[model samples]
Structures are given as structure tokens and as C-alpha cells.
Target: MTNNTPRVALVTGGSGGIGRTVVERLARDGMAVGVHYAGNKARAEETVAAVQALGGRAVAVSGDVADEHAMSDAFDTVEREFGGLDVVVNTAGIMLLSPIATLDLDDLDRMHRTNIRGTFVVSQQAARRVRRGGAIINFSTSVTRLQFPAYGAYAASKGAVEAMTLILARELRGKDITVNAVAPGPTATELFLDGKDQAAIDTLAKAAPLERLGTPEDVAESVAFLAGPARWVNGQVLYTNGGVA
Candidate 1:
């Protein structure tokens, strides 16, 4: 409301690798941020501390992203603490890999529960609450275009995310809010590097023309652009994959 009030943001899954970087980057952008974590209270607080170390304002909020009521409370906390919300980045998601034939139905369901339903729940609240001139950013994956084997189920879930993200952008027309999704490819994170040998990692690393796996900080820069300065960049899926696709 005042010229001096900093912008506010709520980043789901803010304790994870890429999400953690996003939280700090937004804080660096001068936004008072609400770091939302599903179960890792300690890690979330660590992220809060990192932002504080940077001389930024931050708070850690907890909730399952798929739970409507809990996420509602999380959003309320951000607004209450920071005065108003200007950006919401839904980085909360899970990836389960398998060929469509051998894929466990339960695995597909679990991934869908978190990735699809979770995004909807968070985006619903964001649609209702983010102040005018705010932005909503969602996470998808470049695998949808990469068509990599064993990623069928995961890609399907993210495919739905891409669909919903574009539609939400249009639905928010005239509200001065921008809705978009960032699709990262071959990022080097603990979860990503797990179960892979160095040779395999090197092969995938070179798959991109950039000749290296993407880093969380690399992905965070894209988020920072959308959250702060990319006002006209709405309803687009940014493939932050170093031209792998």
C-alpha cells in the first residue's frame, strides 16, 4: 500500500534444491518471502536463515501443497506478515519415472496427487488472493518435449500442468497478474543425480548444447525474471534447458 512496502511472495516447496534457490533469489530481489514447505520444517527454516543472512525478510510456512485448507492458511500467513502478496511460485512437485507399461498405478497416482492436484490447490488460492500486478509461476518439465523414455507418467502430469498454466493466464485477464510455467531440463540436483553413474551424468550433461547440467541457480534466474521484471511475459512455458529441446 505504501511506496516503501516490499513485494511479497509465497514459494511452495521452498526448502528443496531448486525451490530453495528461488526463495533466496526472490528475497534478493527485495521481496519479503514466505517459504512454504511440506514436511521439512528444519530445512525450511534454514532457507529462511539464508535469506536473513542476505539482509532480507522471510518466514517459513508449512502445508501440503495438495491440501486446500492448509495452503489457504499458508497464503494468509504471507499476506498477514508481508501486507500483500505480489508473486506466487508453485515449485512444489514430485517426479516418478517409469515406462507407461511397467509404471505402478500407485506411483502414477502419487505423482498426480502432488504435482497436479497440488498445483491446482495452490494456484486456486493464488488466483483469488494475489494482489493486482502480481504474478503466478508454476513448474513443469522439458521432458514433455524431450520425450525421454521412463518419463511417461511424469511427463503426463507436467503436460497437464502446462495446460492449466496457460488457461489460468487467460482466465486472469484484466487482473494485471501474469501466470506462467518454467520447464527445466536435466538439472543437477540430489534427486536428479541419484542412481546415476558419472558416465551417465556426463552423457546427459552433454545432451544439451550448453554441455553441462543445469544448476538450481540457473533455474532460479528464470524465476527471478518472471517474479520481478517480466511483466509482458505471460502464459508462456520457458524452457530453461539450455536448448536441449
Candidate 2:
């Protein structure tokens, strides 16, 4: 079900790696995108500019996905400017890797706030507000299936996302709104490469079946599929991991 009437889409963390790709792709697909960011106005504006350069409508909105007030405000901005929402992509998340025994409670709490609570808060709003045939997409990570050593905390949080997505789909069974998540493996994003060295990066890059790390555009392709068309798919956690886990 392709749309040309300019559907509105809100992509949280729109300035980030996969988020930016999702924003750009949805915009190109004829959706008026909401480039949402927590504190990066310049980057968000750049995403919006790129979308505009592609002959699409986009606007940058600021909000904390964990905060209801902020999320509602961002949604209001989208509705006011583009009319109403048809798609919402919850892509705002944080990853702090540490052995479970060495994990900091503060870091764990912070990750939980953004990855779990934030996804829930924004999804709740999407459940109530998205148009009849809209899509509510969430973000997860492939580490949940890989069971990587230092990723326990992050994976735990995304596990919550996996569970919430399935239940949310059942809860919204009559609404025609599909709730789903895309879990990508190691991607070539700043967030995914923050502390790695050259050799380390090369080793990790070749760990996947495809012999290279995933790309933001690769993950965005799965998200875009679930967001538009793919109406029969719901509550699925599609792992776009290059067959790595």
C-alpha cells in the first residue's frame, strides 16, 4: 500500500545513524517526515535538508523520547505542520557495553530509560494517535540473539522491546496498526564503532556472514518495508543481521 498523499512520519533520533537513513527513506517514499532529535538541532536540520533536497517534506523536531511531555510536544509539532501522523519509528536508544559484573547501575538505569521506557512511552502515543492504516516501528539489536558478553545490559533492555512489540500488536489487533521492531547486527555507525581500533574494526566487520558490517541503509531497508506496504506483517522482530546471529 504505497501512499502519495504525503503521510506524516516521526523518526526518533533522526540525526543518528539508522535513524537518519529511516528518515531519508521515508521522506523519499512521499511521507512528510518528522526529523526528531534529543539535542542535536544542527544534525537534525541537515537530515531535513537532505530530505528536502530529494523533493520531500521534512521538519526537525526536538524531544526526549523517555518524557511524555516532550514526545507529545514533538508529535504536536508534526501534526501542526504536516497535518497528522501515519507512521512512527522509535529509533532513539543507547548502548553501554560492560561485563555484567562490572556494569554500572547508573548506566544500566540510563539505558533502560531510553531503550525500554522511551520505546514504551513513544509507542503508547503511537498506539493512540497513528492513523488507521499506520505503522508503529520499534528498534532492537541483534545482540539479544548473539548473547555477546558485554552486551547483557543492552540486550536485556531490547528484550523488553521485543516483548512489548508483540503484546502491543495483540493489544492493537483491531486498529489496523502494525507494531514491529528491526534488530540489526554490528553496523558501521558512530555508535557501533566508538571505541574500536583499525584491526579490531576490521575483525568485527568480517564476523558477519556477508563478510562485512551492516550499514544504516541496510537496516533502514527493513524498517522502510515494515513502515510502508507489508501491511500483513505485525509484532515481528525482523533481524537484519546479515545472518550473523
Candidate that would win on lDDT = 1
- TM-score of model 2 (CA atoms): 0.96
1-245: candidate 1 lDDT, tens digit per residue: 45566899999999878999999999988999999999999999999999999899999999999999999999989999988898999999999898999999999999999999999999999999998878999999999999999999999999999999999999999999999999999999999999999999999999999899999999999999999789999999999999999
Report the Cα lDDT for candidate 2: 0.92
Cα lDDT tens digits for candidate 2, 54-98:
889999999889999999999999999998999999999999889
Off by over 4 Å in 2: 1-4
Model 1 spans with C-alpha error above 4 angstroms: 1-4
Backbone clashes in model 1, listed as residue pairs: none
Which whole-number lDDT from 0 to 100 does residue 179 have in model 2?
A: 92
* Global lDDT scores for all candidate models: 0.94, 0.92
lDDT at 161 for candidate 1?
95
> Which 10-residue window in model 1 sums to the lowest lDDT?
1-10
